[model samples]
Target: MSDTSALPRPLLEPPAPQPNPGASGPWTGLRTFATAPFRARAWKEFAYLIIVFVLGCLATAYLFVMVGGSLYLSVLVIGVPVLAAVILGGRVWGRIYRVLGTVLLNAELPEPPPFTFRPGPIGWLRSAFTDRTSWRALLFLLLEAALGMVVGYLVLMVVALTALVTVSPVLWAWKDPHNVDARGVSHHSMVQFGDYYIETWPRVLAFAAIGVLGCFLLPWLFRGVCFLHRVLAAWLLTPTRRDRALTELRESRRAAVDDATATLRRLERDLHDGTQARLVGIAMALGRAEERIATGGDAEELIAQARTSSKEALTELRELVRGIHPPALDLGLGPALETLAARCAIPVELRVLLPVRPSPAIEAIAYFSVAELLTNVVKHAAANRIWVAVLPTGSDALAVSVRDNGQGGALQPADASGEAVVAGGLSGLAQRARGVDGSLFVDSPVGGPTVVTLVLPLAGPQ
Candidate 1:
């Protein structure tokens, strides 16, 4: 005995007609097939093939002359320079192909970093001689020259034949005033069968239909050729792995230098404003005390004032040093995190599970990153309890997870305090982690839990 209410129910009215998903249904497929010849992508690819074919021919001639002439002139004194020029020209041709790919095929290829040659002809020639990218580009041009000529000529001939045949019905009668073939059969068209020429209107119409079908398939042929060209471009035009690594290394070095500069500036500002000002007051107070003693007046009050100012200055100075390199980090990351957990306003459940100690630099980054996370939680999370855990992610990595039960959102959110997020006097703990080739991940949603994790290499940035 089953419940009918829970079993099933059917609608009283038929469902509305849904739009076809472009790949379903005979009608939709037929419509796409009919209209594919006129689509923008098909036309663009065809235009690209035509342009490539023309450029390929010109490039073929230029490369043949320059390469052959340079080789033939190798025994002469000017051969080296001529060869260098040809190599540089290959790079220029590479740029042209990249541009054409962008305009016609809507592909954006990555460009290699520019060469930095020394100030001399020898240096310029040396750069061209050792350039991997230029050599590859030259090879790409050669392949394009050969294949482009073949594909272009073939597609062009097919196009011409189809165009002529498609309009055969309209011009068949005008081809001859009598509308007859050489057989003198009246109403005959130019087409010939096995034993007899086509001599009827229906046969002429059928020939035109075949031409129309060919026109329909021409776009697909164009697409196939362009697809091959795309593969070739991607393989040769983009930077090699070494080039990409060099680029990333340059960027990371710049970021690290910028971070260090900002840190120094901040420390200078803090010393001038807080510790330096306090020390200056201490000096003034001691001077006043000396003058009072010389005049046989009371000096104890001024002396006490100077003592207070000196203590405050010493404390501020100590804090600035700790900000640079925390004393607790010298012991280990575990002890440093424990000290942070003790200082946080919220109750924290802390855990450390590492079998081996990491380098001092990595420990410092992990320490500072955790400290920053705890600070954000106290300032904005409005939470009652927090959790901190330090552990090894793998043989090569150390990971720290700081989580809080609070009103959750990403650690960084776009809001009215955009300057606070992007300006000076704000913390860049995330950037510090990245300086060591580390990563930070944040998992915070709008509710009651937010977790931020920092992963650093155990050995240091590679």
Candidate 2:
């Protein structure tokens, strides 16, 4: 790929406009309020709220009875199975709630952990005793049942209030006009506020206007309530911080180990096919040359051919050694990185401000890391400038940064494909760094300028 380092850096573009599903414009606030009660979404949410409230009340009572009974009956052998059944039942309901939340509330709840079966009776008991997932699910079920009733009721009330106010004028008009009090005035109004009544046309209009105002505020109010519920569900439903961290660590460790194994296999294959093959050819050529000399034939031609094979073998050996560990790294990281910079497709401004040198392994890692990062910039980032820096981190580490003025946007996104598209380019680098107790951080916003920083401990991999 061509490195357009001579080209000038482009101006950063403004952020693209995001699509908004709600109302817009100067009068959007009033328009939303006036039309809130009529919106299909509002009605749908109200219907969902009603369903949840009734179901939650039933569920709350049932779970409370079942769980309470189970705890009381724990002294009996039947209690153990009963409690286990309740927990397992809770997980089933938890999954159902997750689906409901996704459809009704648009909350993307994470998948709960899988239930693992154990082999013997003792093993089964142990599994049940240590089932964190089941316990969490039961807890969420209890919380959802108890809180769902209150939150769902509040949501319904908000919708009902808006609907009532919206139809106040028509409701008052339909009231029995002949009904009157001792003052000869109608006791009922379109809508009643304590003793006050909205009976007159002007008053009805004003009350309807207030209803319209309520309608506009409904969406936001509804969202606020839903947001609280979503947060609660997320906290109670998703994996905890420790679980997530451990998961990440396990993945990284697996990646690193797999990468190392792959690399070793690749190296073995390369040697067998390249350097070793060339050495075998050279040996055969020399043997022929020796045979020619003894037989008093034209040995000069054979010797020359053998010499060419030997040179080729040497070249292959050098390339293989370089792949294993760059010879430039023996001098130090600074010179090694400079050699890498010199070979980059783009103009890389190299800076090394290391007061101390790290171990050989650390130097090799720094070298290859810079090499790969620069390669990415040259190939992927259509940039005009690149800066590479390697600096010592005080007493016990090394920091390497690669910055480019490119059309950035290389950060990983939430991809449901579970494919390694994001992990393809920089993930290997990250895994390699992790192998040495190091980290790789990328800051590439969707415009220009991409910065990738790698940090390693001086003591090297533990």
TM-scores, one per candidate: 0.76, 0.77
lDDT of 2: 0.74
In candidate 2, what are the lDDT values of residues 1-462, reduced to their tens digit? Answer: 112222222212223456786646788877766777678766555555666678688778768798889877888988987877777676777776677677778788887566776998777777776778778777776677766798777767877888888887787788644345557776656455666766678988898888787877877676666676677678777777877665667776898778778889988998898878877877887888888778888878767876887888788778878988999988888889889888888888988878777888888888888888888887778997899877766678877878899987765343776442234767788777777777777766677677777888887965
* Alpha-carbon shift of residue 264 in model 1 (angstroms): 1.1
**Steric clash count of candidate 2:** 3
Can you write out model 1's per-residue Cα lDDT over 1-462, one digit (the tens) per residue? 111112111111122345667657768768877888989988888888888889889889988899889978978979988988898787888888888888888886888668666668888888888888888889999998977777787887888899988988877878753445456666545766655655578888888999999888888888788878878887898888888777667766777799789899999999989888998899999999999999999999999999999988889988999998999988888889899999999999998888889988888878877887888788878899999988777788877777789887443345776433211212355556666776665555566476666777898887
Count clashing residue pairs in model 1.
1
Residue 59, candidate 1: alpha-carbon lDDT: 85
TM-score of 2: 0.77
Candidate that would win on lDDT: 1
